[model samples]
Structure formats: structure tokens, C-alpha cells
Target: MLTTGNDTVLSKRATKTANTDEFLLTQFEKAEANLFHAKDNPEGIVNMGTAVNRVMEVELIERLTKPDALRFEQRYMHYFNNSGLLELRQAVADTLTRHLAPDNPVSPDNLAIMNGAGSCLDALAYTLCDPGDVVLTPTPVYTRIFTDIEERGQVDVMPIVCKAVPDNAEESFRLYKETVEDKILETQSAGRRVRALILVNPNNPLGDIYPPGLLLDIMKICAKYAIHFISNELYSLSIFDEDANFQSVLSFKDIPDPERTHFIWSMSKDFALAGFRTGVIHTCSSSVMKCLGKIALYQCTPSLIQHASATLLSDKAWCDDFYLKINRQRLRDRYSCCLARFRGAGITVRKAKAGLFIWFDLGPYLRSRTKEDEMDLFQEILKRGVYIVPGTQLYCEEPGWFRASFAVSEVELEEGLKRIQQVVEERKQKGQVSWSTY
Candidate 1:
């Protein structure tokens, strides 16, 4: 056992949380009828609960193999040059003009096919950041990007604090703007050039969409300081409600120095094409795009996935109907199930307009522990057998916040909700002031 007598211990993703991400992979228990546990390693007991069942992990992976997908995958038989099928890239560029662009639609030449968002991020870092540079980002970041920018690229990551508007119907752009402004000023004043202002439109763990105006405000600051703006909009189409859906920065007309803006998109979330591993980096700069292409020339995405995405792009109705409909419904349903259960139990659920998650507020429970690291809440939940990504995985400075993904089926979500409720109930019985609200 490790001791957590220091307050700063919670700052790092330690052995406890690191192993937790791996253990999050689970299987349903036939013996218990309604519990989740490790799939292959029987002795690897991480989490068990009435809320989630792990029995269908194999089946879940199999669902990606629809006959249509097979046909889609087969269309990639004509991979000629390493630039990733010109027709496919063109299709992507055309679809992007419809989906994102305003006046200056991204030409096919401005797009660089990437292995995934990770590759695009790495390419950006390789092109921009020196080892001593500082990369400014908000808390609850894209976890994988942390590795590419900070670990692989060896750049400093400055975390900007984000706050929520209490009692609001949803995410407040006001607070986000305020926090970002403060960080910009602080970094600039410290004689550090914030090389890039990276943002996740629908924040990963928080699951909230930033307002377009907030994005514009951020752009002004970036332009003022000459910092590159990296916007990851992979979950752009999964907004639960239509009004919550905002335009991409690529769609912004008044953005100063449009060439400094880089947009990343993929077929992962909205298409549930998670394994497809398709993404594109779009910009108006030839030099930037050429640099991005060199990286693609080295580590190319799967020829088939790229082919399928291109073909899929040509069929806009499929994107609107199949791709958009499936994920959006799943987003709303899972969100409702999770929120209703948690809120019914009096837990304060954060406001999320879009995305497949609701950032959880475990502040109540963490404050209750009084003398433990944030991992205490995570460990306790695992002992009950519910796997969730701790907020710190996204480089969140606040230890109490955690993420609950709403990407599973409705039935699974309901079960997961029940397990969380069970955890709350058990903690209450122990006379500890545990959390029950959403």
C-alpha cells in the first residue's frame, strides 16, 4: 500500500489509475446473472456490480462487421500511391465542404489523410513544437493527445481550468471563455509563448459543447498571440439536441489568419466506426499540409478504411441517416438513462449537450473521503465492479471528477446506472457521506 498523505499525489495518473484504464475492459458474468468482470483473465477482479454486464464484449466487437461494412472495406482494392486514394481524399474534402466549410471550402489539395486523430496530432507537434515549447490546453483533454504532445514530442502542457455554470440547463460557454482568457494572460506574462491553443469542441470527459462565440473569442486570443488553433471535432455530429450543434472553427468566416487554424475529423464516434481508424487534417496552408503529408507518407492509415470513408462521404444521406442517426440516438438514450438514474438519486450531473458521456461530479464523495487521493473513489467503484475513466486521464487537475462513457447500448447503460446506484447505496450504508446525484 501506498500512502497519499500529500495533496499533490492526486496530480499524476499513478499506478492505481493507469491500471484502471486497462481493467476497464470487461465481460458479463453468467454466474451472477447481472454483473461485469474481466473477460479473459478470471482472476483479474477489477469491478463487479448489478448495473453493468460484461458477457457481450465479444459480440460488441463483432457488430462492426456488417455486410455493408464488408462491401465498404472491399472497395479499397485499388490502392495506387501512398497519398491514400485520391478519389477518397477528394470525397472527404467534398464532404467536409458540406459539413464544415463556410465560404472558403477546403479544397482536396488542403487535406491530408491521417492514420487517425493521434497521427494528425503527432504530425502537428512534430511540425510545430520544440522540446522546450509549452502547449496550452484546457483540463479534461483528449487523453491520447497528451502522449503525442507531451511524452513523444517532449513539450510542456499548461492546463487551463474550466468551470461549469451551476444550476444552468447545460454547459456554460461564459465560464470556459473566462478560464481560457486567464490562462492565455498568465502564460504570456510568464514570458512563455503558448505555441498552440488546443481545444476539444465537445470536451472529452466533460461532454459539453463549447459555443461558437466562445470558439471565436478563443480565436481572437490565439490570433493576438499568433498561437496555432488545433480543434478536434470528431464528436461534432453526436450532439443530442439539434440546437446544441455548433459550427466548426473551419466554418468561421471572420477568423483572423485562417491559415493558422487546423481541423481534425474522423469516422469513429458518429459512425460507431471506432475501428475504422480514419481521420483527416484540414488547413489552408500548403506548407503545413505538405508537412502533414510527409508524416502520412510514412505511416499511412488503412487503405480500406480510407476508401470506405471516401465512398461513404459521397453518400451524404448515409452520413445524415445511418451514421448520424444511430450515434445520436445512442447518445440521447444513454445520456437520459445515466442522468435520470443519477439525478433521481440526487447526484448533480454535469450539463452536456452532445457527446457520448456525462462528466461526473464525485466532488461530494471525494470531499467526504477527507483523507484520501481521488483514486479512492475510483478504487471503491472498481471494487463494486463498474469501470469508468477517471477525469485525471484527461489531465484534469481536479481529482474528484470522472468520466462515464455513454457509448454502450441502452440495456448496458441502464445496468451501468444501476451498478453506480448500488455503489452509492453501499457507501451510504457504511455511514460515509457518499454521492448519489448525477
Candidate 2:
């Protein structure tokens, strides 16, 4: 028997979970319950908090529903490979080889397919570390990774706080090799084992892609400490910036620790198929692959979904030649539109080169630069029928930073921005300084 702060709890594990922060999820549920549908429910909540790509929904549905696209066979009705259907794994491997690892062709044998990226993270956490072991990632990141690694694996995530340098607004929230090594050593010295270091390349919330040089340096540090390196390159194809050089870890010719390095990706983001529930892990380590095989029974993707995913990936004419190119252009267009609106509203936003959302500074809207003030502003925006993620949920040390997804329908995007602008105007009328004035 256990009790939480509210004094109503059952099991010890339930109390532990109840004590964890779930504000973002709670808001998401509320937003979903009353979603804004332009012609249906215009006054309902316009969701910009969730990182989903709805801009290409029509294109995806059209292609996926083609006659030959998802033909059902007897194989679909029977149990297949628990890891992934061979055809799907090979298709995934081939796609990665062509795009991410041109130099080193990815092998299907090294791939483990799971239900989704969240499940992949959970599986990796369980396989790579024991309960209470630490996995380090830089902040502020996708907040869900904290629970994905912790809830089932009982592992802990230690954030290497990467605060932006004061007085230099132009500088990005940079993660240094020294900072990472120091944190790793400090954690180990404290009698706790640091088993892995996970990074979301082309980072979430920030929407900045890491440099190749920095990635190499970080890998060397992980190798020096003999810890696993997991790169969540979920947005590898979401790079809309023409000049941005996005490199995959698999492309590196010389890996310091090939056996310990792993890559994660999913159809949810790149292909705009969140409902598909398909994710893959590419790892060279035989031991890790073996462990993942045993765990796949619980989290394996369904055969029919795997077949459809394979068909989509196999069609180079549609996938490589058409879908990706158009998706990137659409992403660029939506991002540009969202940016212009925010700038026009006298708000300051960090320009994003990749990913679905934009990180912007709303510090001027707050009465004080505090988390409480940030939440108050968030609630105010929510009251205006718009939902954007507050920085506090992302473990951001700084207050008044928020994320809003631009990967939505033009109408929804405009409506969300309009509501946000209304909030800003209301706050301004009440004496809050405009972001542009700063």
C-alpha cells in the first residue's frame, strides 16, 4: 500500500507514476475531446501541441488506398515473423541504404521492427540497461522519451541541460562533447551506472539538425565510456531546408563503437502515418538483436500493417520519386506560412529547418519569467481554443518558450495562429510587452 501527495493511491508503482508530471498528456486528452473541425466544430480546441503531420493526409490516404497498395492475402491472417515480415524488413533496409547509409548498405538481418517509436525506445531501454540505470539525453527534448524509457524499463533519464548562452539570442542550445563526457563521468562516480546516451537528431522542439563533427565527437565519448549510443533519426526525411546537410550515423565510415551504436526510425513522422504504428531499430550488435527478438512478441507490428508498409516502401516511383519530394515541399510551405504569421503577430520564433514544430519565445507575454507564468499563458491560450506545448513540459530550464506544430491543414493552422494572436493581443492590452518590442 502507498499514498501520493493527494492521499489517494493503491500500489507503490501506481503512486510513483501518479507523482510523475503528466500535464502535457492531460492537456492533449482535453484538446482531443473537443477538437476543432472547421465546418463541424469551429469553436472547439485547435491542436498545435502534438507533433503530427496532417498536411499530407490526403496524399497518403490516396496512395495507400490504391488497389494494389494493400491487397490482403492468406499470409495476413496468419501469424508471421514476430520481429517483422521479411519483405518489410528488406524494404526498410533498402530504403535506409539508399538514403541514410549509401556508403554502408543497411542489412535487414540487423533490423528489428516494433509497433512504434515509443515501443522501440521502451524495448531499447529494457535491453540496454537494468532497472535504475541511467540514460542521458540533452534538454529540452521530446518530453515523452522520459516516460518511454522509464515507465516499463524502470530506467532513469538524466538530462544534460543545454541552456542557450545569455546575451546571445542567435546562438543555438548547443550540446558540447565536454559537457556530455563530464555528465557521464559524474554519473558513474556517483555509484550509478550510465548505460546509454540517446539523442534525437534534427532535434525535437528546437528543430535543429546536429553537425556531423559534433556527432562524431559525441560517439567517441560514448565509445570511451563503453556506453550504448542510440540515435532517434525519426525526422531524417523531414528536412525541408534546401541547404541543410542532414547526415545519418550509419553513413559514417568509421564508427568508434559499431557494436554499441543503434538507429531508430518510424513511419509516423517521415511518412505521415502515425496510425500505422510501425517502427524499426537498426543495430549491428548481435547480442542486442537477439534480446530484441525475444521482446518482439509483445510489441511486434501486425502482419497486415507490415505488408502495407512494405508495399509503400517498395514502390520507388511513389515513395522516393514522388511522396518524399512533395511532402518536403509542403512542409516547407506550411512552415513558412506559420513563421510569417508568428512574425506578423510581433512574436519571436526560432527558425526551424526540420521537424514538424517551431520553438518560439513568448517571454514578453509573461508577467515574470517563471514556469508558473508560462503555464498561466498556456492556459490563457487554451481558453481561446488553441493548444500549444509549454516549455516546462519539455524540461526546459528557461520559461516562456513554447512549441506549436505547423504540419496541419492550412485552415486549422490559420485558425490556431489566429487564436494565439488573440491571446497575445489580449495579454498586450493588459500591459504585457510584445515579443517584437524586446
The lDDT of model 1 is 0.66
Q: 163, model 2: CA deviation in Å?
A: 0.6
Task: Please identify model 2 stretches exceeding 4 Å from their true place.
Answer: 1-11, 18-21, 434-438
Tell me the tens digit of each residue's lDDT in model 2 across 195-260.
Answer: 999999989988888999999999999999999999999999899999998899989999999999
Instruction: Specify the highest-lDDT model's number.
Output: 2
Q: Per-residue lDDT of 136-156 in model 1, one digit per residue for the tens? A: 888766566666576556677
Worst 10 residues of 2 by lDDT: 164-173
Output the lDDT of residue 168, model 1.
Answer: 45
User: By summed lDDT, which 10 consecutive residues of candidate 1 come out lowest?
Assistant: 47-56
Score each candidate by Cα lDDT. 0.66, 0.90
Highest-scoring model, TM-score: 2
